[model samples]
Target: MGRYFRRKLLIYGVTFVIAVSINFAVPRLMPGDPVARMLSRNKVANPESSEAMRAYFDNVFGFDVPLWQQYLNYWAALFKGDLGVSVYAFPASVSSVIAGALPYTLALLLPAILLSWIVGNSLGAMAARNKWLDNGVLPVGYVFTAVPYMWLAILLAWVAGVILGWFPVAGGYSFALTPTFSWVFIVDLVHHWFLPFLSLFIVALGGWAIGMRNLVIYELESDYANYLQALGAPRRLVRRYAFRNAMLPQITGLAVALGMVVGGALVTEVVFAYPGLGSLLLSAINNQDFFLLQGILLFIVIGVLVFNFLADVVYVLVDPRTRLGLEGGQS
Candidate 1:
């Protein structure tokens, strides 16, 4: 187990390096000059002043340096936790801007992903055992999983926010309310949070349900299950084993979903105009804010790598087969 985790850690470390390098390169490759965009947005009209400001901005952003030096500086600054200043939200550090939005993204993602997985897997397992439920759940699960995230978000926004007027259509909270710890602010937060959360939850729930249902069915029909039943093991005992065995892949899926939380359901966030990393990323792109975009992408890359590593740890803990396989391979 020690050797197994060490190997996994080494692999993840290499992956993180490659991912960060790509994240750094992709933004620099994007068309247009971010400094120029910033100057234009700030309305720096006089040519002399514009030239002076451009020089100043380029030096400050390290754009004056050669590409190779800039790459090295990026790594150095990254180690110091300096994500650079945001071009779009001028004068604000990229870290601070991302910090402001991180909570909302987490609030939307964590509950939605976790609840969907738990409920979906339960429903799927139950459906596998009952023919009547299988008839109803299978098609519904297919429909829910088939719906695109953005489409569902739009449909929900229209029906729930527009037509019914049950929830606010845009923003993380009511613009009228100042952010505070008061009951009024908290309630208002949940009010705006519900629709986006529901959209994510509903869409994710179906895929998990369908996957779990199929896995459970396959496990129940596997040779071990048949042999157990032939030996007159109780039906309940056999099914319990089947359910546990079927959950392995679902665990992996849940981990991957959690890993992607930092990406913040990009299209859904755009549709709802939610104040999260996804919306921030869109703003960064539109404004050619390379620093901000790099910061966001960095978070996403780290989140995915970290969560995937955790998933491997979890698999080793939960599944005896994984442990046995590793042990045998080592031997």
Candidate 2:
């Protein structure tokens, strides 16, 4: 087991390095100069002042350095836990910018993914048993899964926010209120959160439900199920066994879904002007904020790799076949 984990760790480490290198390379390869954009936005009129500003920006943004040297410096800074200051949000560290947006993204995504998976799996498992439920819920599940996430978000915003005026159409909270721990602030936060959360939850639920239903049905019809039935095992016991076994794939799916939470729900944020990483990411791109973009991508990469590693460990623990293979290899 130790050997297997060491091997996995080594692989993950290599993948992380490669992913980081790619993330660093992409922004540099893109067209347009970030320094130029910053100056343009600032609009320095006098040529001497413009020249002074240009040189200052060049020094601040490391445009004065050679490409190879900049790349090396990037790695060194990263090792020292420096993500650099945001070019667009000048004077603000990349870490701080990302930190500010992290909460909204998490608040929007975590509940959506978790609740959807739990509800979907339960409903799907039940659907396999009751034909009436299977007939009724399956179509609804299909519609939810098939709908585009952004499209659903827009529809919900229009119907609920625009027409019914049930919720705020945009922003993480009411702009009129200051952020605080008071009940008023909390209520406003949930009011704005509902549409985005619902869009994600409703969309994700169908996929989980459909996948679980099929897996449960298959497990019930598998040879082991028949053998247990022939031996007169109680229906509940047989079903309990099948359900436990059927959960393996869902466990894996859950991990991937969780891993994606950091990068997930981009469209929903865009639609609602939610104060999250997705909105921040758009701003970063528009202004060619390389450091900020790199930081966001790095965050996403680490999240995915960490969760994937955990999933592998969990799968080996729960699935006897995987454990047996590793054990046999040691022999």
Candidate 3:
């Protein structure tokens, strides 16, 4: 197990280096100069003033330096936890901007992902055992999974927010209410949060249900289940084993989903105008904010690698077959 983990860590380390390099490269490859965009947006006219501002902006953004030096400086700054200044929200540090937006994304993602997984898996497992449930869950699960995230978000916003007037159409909370710990504020937050959360939850719920249903059915038909039944083991006992075995893949899927939480649902965020990393990223891109874009991408890369590592650790802990395979490979 120790050797196995060491190897995994080495792989992850190499992957991180490569991913970070790609993250750094991607934003620079994009067209348009961020500094120029900022100047244009601010309307910094006049030859002397424009030149002075352009030079200042270039120096501050490290565009005056060679590409190789900039890359090296990026790594150095990254090591010291400096994500640099944002181009879109000028004068604000990239880290601070991301920090402000992180909570909203987490609030939306965590509950949606976890609850959908739990409820979907339960429904799928139940459906696997009952013919009537299988008929209903199968079609509903397919439909839900097939719907696009953005379209569902729009539909929900139109029906629930605009037409029905049940919830506010956009924003994280009501503009009138200042962010505070009061009951009124909390209630308003939840009110705006519900539609976005529902869109994510309902979409995720379908895929898990379908996947688990199929896995459970396959597990129940596997040789071990047949043999257990042949020995006159209780049907419940056999199903308990099947469900446990079927959960291994679902655990992996859960890890991957959790890993992607940092990226969030870009289209959904855009549609709802929710203040999250996804919307922030879109702003970064539109304004050619390389620092912010790379910073967000870096977070995404680190998140995926970290969560995937956790998943590997979990697989070793829960699945004896994984351990045996490792041992066999070592031999």
Which candidate wins on lDDT?
Answer: 3
Q: What TM-score, computed on C-alpha atoms, does each candidate reach?
A: 0.97, 0.95, 0.97
What does candidate 1 score in Cα RMSD to the true structure? 1.2
Q: TM-score of the candidate numbered 1? A: 0.97
lDDT of 2 by residue, 204-293 (tens): 999999998899999999999999999999988888888888899898898888877655588899999999999999899999999999
For the record, the alpha-carbon RMSD of candidate 2 to the native fold, in angstroms, is: 1.5
Q: Local distance difference test, per candidate?
A: 0.92, 0.92, 0.93
Instruction: Give candidate 3 misplaced runs (Cα > 4 Å).
Output: 262-264, 327-331
Question: Which model, 2 or 3, shows the larger lDDT?
Answer: 3
Question: Which residue pairs clash within candidate 1?
Answer: none
Error of 3 at 201 (Å): 0.3
Candidate 3 lDDT tens digits, 1-331: 8899999999999999999999999999998888888888889669899999999999999999999999999999999999999999989999999999999999999899999999999999999999999999999999999999989999999999989999987999999989999999999999999999999999999999999999999999999999999999999999999998999899989988987875547888889999999999999999999999999999888888888999899999888999999999999
**Candidate 1 regions with alpha-carbon error over 4 angstroms:** 262-264
Clashes of each: 0, 0, 0
Residue 214 in model 3: shift from native, Å? 0.7
User: Each candidate: RMSD to true structure?
Assistant: 1.2, 1.5, 1.3
Query: Is candidate 1 or 2 superior in TM-score?
Result: 1
Q: lDDT of model 1 at residue 202?
A: 94
